[model samples]
Structures are given as structure tokens and as C-alpha cells.
Target: MVAIALCAIGCQNLSLPSASTATTPVVIKLSGWGSDPTEQKLLKQVLKDFETQHPGIRVKYEVISDQYMDVIKTRLIGEAAPDVFYLDALEAPFLMSQNVLEPLDAYINSEFDLPDFEETLINSFKYDNHIYGLPKDYSTLTLFYNKQAFATAGLTSPPTTWDELLTYSKQLTVDKNQDGRIDQYGYGVIPELARQAYKIKAFGGQLVDENGYAAFASEAGLQGLQLVVDQYQKDRTSAQKSDVGTNSGSEMFGQSKVAMVIEGNWAIPYLKETFPQLDFATAEVPTINDKKGTMVFTVAYVMNKQSQHKAEAWELISYLTGKEGMEKWTATGFALPTRQSVAQKLGYEQDPVRSAFLAGVEYAMPWQAGKHPAAIMNNFDNQFVSALLGQQPLKQAMQRAQAEANKLIRAME
Candidate 1:
């Protein structure tokens, strides 16, 4: 009965055992947000492979599709959450502090190769010295540029410093029609908090205070963010999604509306499939304030505290995050493997485009800011965009955003 329901919703080509099986196997429920069709197919294959190895356990996978966090939180509060589920690093601190997630420290052993995982990726899920989750995969931002655009602009190489990037943007910006409308923007900008977190740190500013309140309005933070505003308002060389009439920076870059964009590994496959004829290459993101910085995003498998199948749940989590399963899951490049051994085996570091992303892992900042990042990010993005559009001064805008974010955080507390 459970297998039928699972098969009806996004589980492809899953074959379950008949009722005549010698022993009734334990059913372990797993849940995650839906991804691209190719990614989903790969994940389902991983789950099926696990089931084949452990005939005593039946894995039931479900896709929440939308409003993933809200659905998971509701199910958790009602004690009906799946035994294991995908938890983003952005949400890890909040959930780990709530006493709702099971600590996996006891379940992991030396042979599990705990040291094989990336230090930063594993540390994101660590709270009070207990590991609550294990990162399945991670991605870091890289500079994506169109080779043809660079050639047309007579540029020889991608920018390595912020000053060079600004200069290059001017050379790359063009208006072929001379109708006072830009035919091609020099750079694509995504002004969201996720993409800009490292900017705040570049100038010695932080996203939150020691008490977990919003504190990005410091002079240091404003100093770093000013570059973005100046590029948009003064230079007019960079554009947002609405300016280009595209859905995302990736789409805008793929459409040749922009010459360069800061994107992650996921965009590699996307650009290949959607714009095969476009000549593009990647480089490490330009340095700002003479500092190297980029953002890292990762998702982990976390166990539910109230789950009845804790043992089986750990088995699934360990296997999926283990070297073997991660290799198979990340083999197709939907996401980069988090394990060092798997990364070595996959040899993505040698790939031209991917090597640029791999270079960022050493200095990338995890996309997390305490437990209330969602609230902080929401307020900051709203006011930051206003500042970018010249509605208010950058300093004033950040001050207002910080105040509003803290008020909401207090209310939530």
C-alpha cells in the first residue's frame, strides 16, 4: 500500500517486493524538495540502489514540490515528518537548535570516513559540538563569461580584481542600435542576500550580531555594498532580471543579454542544454577589497528526532552521504560531491569550467547567518533593491532594513 502511494508521486520505475516476501521489511520514509528531472532521476536511482543492498529495509521517497520548509516544519510539529529529509544549510541552525533533529555523532564511526568530508560543509551542521546533519552535496559561485562577448570587446581574459571587472564592464557594455537602449549589459546582477553575504564580510561586516539580530548596516557592510549600487546607478553597466526581462541571471546570460554572471555548477548543465551554440567559459569570481570571497550552498540529510525507525534512518543517511552513494549521485554533475575522495574520483577539479568553482571551496563562505537568516535576508533584500534603484541612500536603506529585521526577529522570539 505504501509503495503504491510513493510510486504515484514522482518515484520513477521503482519496483517493490510482493507480499509473499519471507520477512516484512521496515519502511524508512525520506523527503526532499523536487529538482530538475535529471537530478530527480539520479536521486531515485541512489535510493533504489540502497534498497537493493539492504533487502531488510524499504525506502519510501517523497517530493514536497513547493513551500518545502513550511511543509517540513508543519509535519515536524505534528510528529508526522519523514524519518529523514533534506535540510539546507540555511535552515540547519534553526532546526538544530529546536531539539527536533536527531544528533548523528553517535551513529557515525571512524570507518565512515568522517574526516573525508569537507570541514566547512560539515561544520555548518554542527551545533553545541553535535553534528545534526551530513552534507550530501555543495556548490560555490563562479564567474561565467561568454567567450564570444570577450572577443568582441577585445578583452583577452576574465577579470581577477574588482577594479579590472569594473573597467571590463564598461568595455563590454554596448548599444548596437544606438536607440539609447542597451543591447547587451556588461554584467548580470542578482542582488539577493544569498549572493551578497560574502560582500558584507569582505569589508569586515557581519550579517548578524552576536545575539543573532540583524547587524548588516555597519559602515563596513555599506562600504562593500556600495560597489554594487554604483555599478547599477552610476556606471549603468550591470542589470537585474527585471531590467533584462529574463527570469534569472543564468537565463539572461544564456540569451546573450549579458556578458558575464556569477553562477554555480548547476548553470553549467543548464547553459549546455539550453544554449549549445553559445561559447562560454568560467573563471574564479573577482576579488573585492583585496580579499577572496564567494558563497557556498549545501544540503544535508537530517534525521527526525521522533522517528520510529532511527536505526534504519541512519543507515539510509549514512549510505547516501557515504562515498559510494555520493559518487553515483554526483556522477552526472547536477551537484558537486561534498566528499574529498569522491571529488578526487570524479576528477571535476580537472574540468575547465568546474575547476573554477572548485577553486572557491577553500575561501567560500557558507550561506548561513545564525538561526534567523530567513528574516534577515527578506528585510535586507527588500531594502537593498530599493537602495540599488536610488530610492534611498545605501547607508540609510541598510539602517532601516536592520531595524525592521531585528523587530521581526524579536517578535518571532
Candidate 2:
């Protein structure tokens, strides 16, 4: 009777499942802004691969199509933010200072190879010696020129200096049909503070003071900006997107409304897929003030401090920003890899068109303003556009912009 009872107990134990096999998968909420369809598809595939490798964790990806930063900020305040999300470098300073993001230092292990990422990009997410985010990818501005336009203008090479670029612009501007209205402009200009930050730095001008106040109205700043103003108001060789009835600089260039434009890596896939017939080539942005300069824009994957599944969140971030995942993400050339190993493995430096962008990274200025970036960016862009339209003098416009931005920053404080 005792042996039969023991045998019955053993049979019951054998019928039950193990704890590990019966455990439910943790779901991580991941969020980012909407991108091109191809980029979105690639990201989805990466997530799928991550799930395949990590069957115990599933990522619930969400795309906030518009006002991404505003939505994220609101969600963070309500403690309803995703476990992991994308953060732009421009907005990193503010959020990193807010103590809402998880400091990733503890979660990172040596095998993760933090040193593999580009120093410039990685440093952007570091604040107070704590790494809050890991940069996923970066893009540096490059000058994109129409090859057919160059041939028509009898130009053998892209401009090597800003002066040469202006000269080339004059030659490329044309009134093809002689209808009195200009058919094509030489350059497409984006009169926004983000695109012009490097130009401001070209002449020792800065976007903000040591205390983070607006400081871009100095005499040195105007020198670099005057070049842009002169091209638009004085020479009339440059056209804003609105002037050409186009939506963006890339569109203006791709549609042949402008012969040249300064754009980033995203424009390459866009131009190729959208305007397949356009013959375009990219070159390092022409030197400004006899110094090499361009803007580097980067985005990082960050963790929410309030996440219930912190380990699962880090797993998603590490996998997405890891070498293997970065290689797969950047393989399409829609964006450049932030990891040096991935960049080397992909060989973007050897690519004929992409090489220009890669070369500019060494001298590129990260696209970050102070903690209060929107105030400075908005005021400067509004006034700069006014100056470009001859509505006001450059000096006065910038001065007004600087004062207004500083006033807003003070109010925020």
C-alpha cells in the first residue's frame, strides 16, 4: 500500500509543467516617431528578430506620428510612458536633467562594448556622468548637387569652399524658357536654426551662452549668417521651400527646382526611391570660414525610469543598438550606424556618395542647443526667415530673436 501511494505522487508531479516553461512573456512598450515606410519596415523586422531570439519578451512598438516630443513629455509626467522610447539628441539635455529617464550605466555590461559607439554620438546622451541613452544612429549634413546641372553649368567638381559654392550657384541659376519667371534656382535653403547652427559656429558664434541663454546675436555670428542672407536677398540665387512650392529641400532638389541643397543621409534613399531619374551626387559640405563644419543629428534609445520590467526594457535597447542589430538596421543606408564596428562592417566610409557624410562627422557639431532649445530655435528661425525675405536687416532680426529667446528662457526658469 505504501509503494502504490508513493508511485501515485510521483506520477502527479511528472504531469505538472516546470516553472520556466509555464512563465508568461514580459511585454515591453517601445515608441518612436513615424519614419519612411522602408525604415518602419526595417525596424519592425529588427523587432521581430529580437523576439525570435528572446522568446520570453515581446516588444509592443508604437509610432507617434506627430508632435512626438510633446506627446512623450506629457506621457512621462503622467507616468504612462513606454518602457523604452526614442529620444532626439536636441531634446536629450532637457530630459536627462529631469530625472525621469533611467540611467543605463548599471544595466550595461562590458561585453555590450560601449566603446564601439562613436564618441561624439555617445557623449550626447551622457549627463552628470550618467549615460541615459544609447545612440542608435546618426546623420551628418552633406551637399547634394545635381550631376546634370553641374554638366550644364560646365562645372567639373563640387564646390570646395562657400565662396566657390556661391559662384557655382550664380552659374547654375537659370531662366530656361525666358518667360521672365525664373525656372530653376541654384540653391535650396532651409532657413531654420537647426540647419544653420554649424554656420553660426563657423564664425565663433554660439547658439547659447554658458548659462544657457540665447547668445547667437553677436557680431561674429552675423558674419556667417550674412552669407546666407546675401545669397537669398542680395543675389536671389537661393529659394526657400515655400518659394518653390515644395515641401522640403530634398524635394526642391529632386524636382530640379534647385540645383544644389544641403541635406543628410535620409535624403539619399528618399531621392532614389521617389525621383529615380534624378542624377545626384553628394560632397562634403563646403568649408565655412575656411574651416570644416557640418551638423550631426542623432537619436538614442532611452529607458523609462518607471518601467516595471526594467530588465526587459534594457534587453530591447541593447539588442536594437547592438552591433548585429545596428548593422541590419543601417544596411539599407536610410540612416548611418552609430557603432564604429557597424559602420566599418557596412563600409559606408568607402561608399562613393556616403563617404562625404562619414568624413564630415569628425568636424560636425551635434545638433543640440541648451535645455530650452525650442525657445531659441523658434525665435531665431522666425526672425532669420524675416531677414531672408528682406523684411528686416540681419543684425536687427538676430538681435530681436536673441532678446525674445532669452526672455522666454527667463520666464521658463
lDDT (CA) for every model shown? 0.89, 0.90
lDDT of 1 at 389: 100
Q: Give the TM-score of candidate 1.
A: 0.94
lDDT of 2 by residue, 1-413 (tens): 22233223223322211223326888889999998787899999999999999998889999999999989877776668898999999999988877777889988999999998888899999999999999999999999999999999999899989999999999999999999888889999999998999999999999999999999999998999999999998899999999999999999999999999999998998899899999999999999989999999999999877777887888889999998889989998888999888888889989999999888888899999988999999999999999999999999999999999999999877
User: Can you write out model 1's per-residue Cα lDDT over 1-413, one digit (the tens) per residue?
Assistant: 22233223322332322323347898999999988998888888999999999898899999999999989887776668898999999988888877777789988999999999989899999999999999999999999999999999999899998889999999999997999999999999999989998888999999988899998999998888999999999999999989989999899999999999999998999999999999999999999999999999999999887777777888899999999999999998878989988988999889888988878988999999777887899999999999999999999999999999999889777
Q: Which regions of candidate 2 fall more than 4 Å away from where they truly are? A: 1-22
* Candidate 1 stretches greater than 4 Å from native: 1-22
Candidate 1 whole-model C-alpha lDDT, 0 to 1: 0.89
Report how far residue 399 has shifted in candidate 2, in Å: 0.7
Best model number under lDDT: 2
Of the candidates shown, which would achieve the greatest TM-score relative to the real structure?
1
